[model samples]
Target: MEKQHSFWEREEWLKPPDLMIIGGGIVGASTAIFYKKRFPKHDVILVDKGIAPEGASTRNAGFACIGSVSEHLADLAVSGGETVFSRIVRRWNGLQLLRETCGDEVMDYQNTGGYEIFTDEKIYETCAGKIPWFNQKLKERLGLEDVYSEREYEGYPAIFNRVEGAINSGKLMRFLHERFTESGVRTWWNSRVERVEPGSVMFENGFQINPKKTVIAVNGFVQRLVNLPVKPARGFVFVTKPIPGLKWKGTFHFDEGYVYFRNIGERLLLGGGRNVAKEEETTDQFGTNQKIKEYLTRFANVTLNLPEKWEIDVEWSGIMGMTDNKEPVLQEVKPGLWAAAGLSGMGIAIGMQLAKELVSKLED
Candidate 1:
């Protein structure tokens, strides 16, 4: 039995809106703000399943990085040089938009630089050989020479990216939440959308919302709503207790970004390695696997060489939406129904930008 709302309450809060965006994650919330900004007279509403921003938006590792050296090289191998270059440009644009919309200070954004550690001599040599070529291509696009510099850190061999930075993921999401509220966009948390009709949305609680336009921004959870090409890829992460003298600083990626770690003040945050168990890690569940945990523990001990007795403070997993082509699907699926998913684990920077772009297209 569903509790019914009074006529006054229904008229005030349950009425149809001009734009209703599902999934109050980064993309969904930004989409609401963008639409409201473009159409001030229209009523925009954002609904989320959880009370807070669920999915990877708030659970990410907080690395404000575009792409690592080895990751870029792998992308180039698969998508070719031109396509890879264009994707990088989009990532740069996304970063700029994030900074412009939410001030750097509010997001706790910092340009402390980033690094990629080579685990072996062969890998180091292979990446070193391609550094010159890769640097030239990136410099051409960025209009700056020597974006990456090969360096030695402690006993580990690494390459440094001068343009990389870090941010507090919590702060960034909260900042966006506040901005959305200030912009007069209505947000309904704990509202799980069950079905989407042509001009209405059916909620799990038996309530229906008839909005003029609906945007589905659910990333990893898209399969539950639509039959799209998007699939959920799980990423596990763990953090260590504060170390008094941690040698590593800034963000880091190893083995083509399958493994990454970064320092947050005195504590260290490490994540990734879904590539090791691709089949098991493809589910949308947010649980840890013993095999993956063992691998991460070994990497932290051997690769990062953290001191013994450093406690595992916390561990969690996030699901990222990925596609075969590694490109986000940002288009109108049907009449008055739009979607933005398939970020491929690169959603932090690019998701907000895609929202703005989608809003512009919808307005036009």
Candidate 2:
């Protein structure tokens, strides 16, 4: 009788919210804030399965970056010149919006610049030869003549860009959370949403919430609730204990961004290279893969020239949503049910921009 009663019981929580947003990561949190700001009189509720915002928002490499040099070139090859340039503009706009909304101190935003190391001599030569040409093309968009160059920084062979920067990922999310609360937006952590019905939502725990409008911001975890072509791509990362005399500074990307690392104070935080094993890395599961780990380690030694004696103090992984095309889905799945996901690993910048756009759609 007790078990049956638990299954049907609805706790004395408020009846229902006017707006309920699923997945309290960067995208969802931003969406909730946007809705609350637009409709101050209406109640807005945000839900997440974890005690804190999970998935890629907190798990990213803290790269306050839009694109690396070679990575931009690779994107042009795949997406064409027009598409690649347009995407870069969008990323820049998103970054600007994030800074304006949250402020630099709150987000720990820094413009210490970034680097791309070239371990392979041929790739290095190719990138060096095209630096001027690439810079000329992006000059108008970036408002800078020389966007990249071979600069000797510390002891690494790196191509540096003065435009990029980094941020404290954890602090950024917390700032957004605080902003939401201040705006009278309600959030329910550790609340697992199972289904989204018209004007209502069913929770895994026996609680059902009836909201006038719902926005799904689950990102890579969307497959759990809807039938989308989005799939999860796992990114493995590890941080080193603070080295007293670490020479490297700023962010670094190699092998066309397949491998990436950056300096956080005196410690090194490294991640990426899932392209080494596409099939195995494409899963909703959040765990470090041995193959990717080995590759990252090898890249660290060869590219960054890290000593084998260095200890890996922490290791973790986060899943990113990817689709056939890199564009995110920001449309109403059904009447009263809107979704904004599939960031293709560019969630930090794009998610914030889309969140504002999503709320504007609802207001219309």
lDDT of 2: 0.83
Candidate 1 lDDT for residue 94: 92
Model 2 alpha-carbon drift over 4 Å, by segment? 2-12, 153-157
Cand. 1 TM to true fold: 0.97
Per residue, candidate 2 scores C-alpha lDDT tens digits across 94-210 of 988888988999878889888888756787777778788778877888787687888765554678887788889999999999999999887888998998866889899877778
Candidate 2, residue 38: the lDDT equals 83
Runs off by more than 4 Å, candidate 1: 1-3
User: Candidate 1: worst 10 consecutive residues by lDDT?
Assistant: 138-147
Q: List the residue pairs that clash in candidate 1.
A: none
Best of the candidates, lDDT: 1
lDDT of 1 by residue, 248-281 (tens): 7888989988899999888999999898899999
